[model samples]
Target: MIVVTTPTGRIGRHVLGHVLDGAEKVRVIVRDPERLPAPVRERVDVVRGSHDDPGVVAEALAGAGSVFWLIPPNPRAQSVQDHVIDFVRPLCTAIGDHGVERVVAVSTLGRGITRNAGLVSATYAMDDLIESTGVHYRSLCPPAFMENLLSQVETIRSRGTFFAPISADRRFLTCAVRDIAATAAALLLDGSWTGQDSVPIVGPDLLSYEEMAQIMTEVLQRPVRFQQISGEAFTAALRRAGVSEAWAGGGAAIMAATDRGTYVAEAGSPGPTAPTSFRQWCEEVLEPAVG
Candidate 1:
């Protein structure tokens, strides 16, 4: 059986869909069964509860051989690291208890950097904790998500301006979540690979927020601009928007590390697992969202 956590989430939903296309038995751990699409609800075994709960995880993992693990984003969590640990600890215990053979998890880049990159560091910690259990694991490491720009769709449409905490010219790879899901689903279905590895889902372009804005301008036929904000300002904005202090600080850290060139694609690493380009993403995703 293949068990998927966060099956209704932005990335998870896509992962679930791709996995369901295969012939394997699929089960989902979700907080609310109603959130699942009607057709999807008809197909999989639904264990209705947060994956963060031990009982719920154990219940879902019973007779399951492979697991798709994703920590649902929690902007109001008191502590980012602790929030990740809360979910991962149960799964680690369950992996040992259930003898689950494989784990495919969504993690971020910046695996070995010395500086503290809040959410990135949290994901690294999660990798370590899960690896300690010795389950065959694949960490899907993608850089900044292109869909993150969708959050500024309103501002981009109304004011032709979007904001970021990084420098305007800082080049970094950005990935599409669909690409991440494709990689996860392929791994889940084949189940031929072994012990542990990090799958880098990098997009084709190495771009800056400024280049992205330019692409938006050409694609959307308007003058969209990139506005750079300080990390402090970024965190303060998140706080003002009701995100908890810890999560907001983590956001700042991610941006800070990005600006410091922490997420640059390394030499001779595998080619872009996430093949979506910035222009393609703008034309396909951002343009539709703007409309």
Candidate 2:
């Protein structure tokens, strides 16, 4: 049996689809079962509750051979690291108690760096908490998600400009969520039971925001330009979007770190080959959003 958390999300849904083919039993933990896609909700056992609920997590992990674990960022968290550790520690304990053998956690690149990375700090905490359980674990660490660009689609469509704090020409590694999900599914199904491992899933090539804008413009048949915003401007924009001051500040700091190469991913790590290119992702996913 395999259990997946956050299964309604982009990466989790893909991983669930990939693993459902041959698995005798598959389960998904969701806050609200009714919100899941009809097909997915029907095919898998649904554990209704958040990952913070120990009883729910234990039930989800019961008799499960493998678990795909991911914690969505909470902008409202008092202390992001504490909130993450609070959830992960008990959940890992529950999974262990339930005799779950393997855990595949979704983390991010640049997680080990001690300073200048805000959210990555929390992910590093999660990795450590999961490792202490002594369960066979694999941490899927990918660079910036290409799907994050989707949030700027409206700006591209209406203003013909996509804005970010990073330098438009500074190259950074980027990976598609689908690629991350596929790699994670492979790890779960392979049953290697590697004790503790961190895998960096990089893209075929490094790209800058300007390069990404070019590809997106070509795919959508619109003139799109990358505009570099000041960290202050970025933070204000996030604040206007209803993000809390603390989270907005943290987000701006992370973007600034990326601009300075502090968040740059290391050159190589052992993981699956890049599955999709920026052009491919834009053509297959981004173009449809414009329509």
Give all candidate RMSDs, comma-separated. 1.1, 1.8
Residue 15 alpha-carbon offset, candidate 1, angstroms:
0.3
Worst 10 residues of 1 by lDDT: 263-272
Write one digit per residue (lDDT tens) for candidate 1, span 22-137: 99999999888999999999999999999999999999998999999999989999999999999999999999999999999999876876368888899999999999999999
The residue pairs that clash in candidate 2, if any, are none
Q: Cα lDDT of all candidates, in order?
A: 0.90, 0.82
> What number of clashing residue pairs does each candidate have, in the order they appear?
0, 0
The best candidate by TM-score is 1
Model 1 off-target regions past 4 Å? 266-270
The model with the greatest lDDT is 1
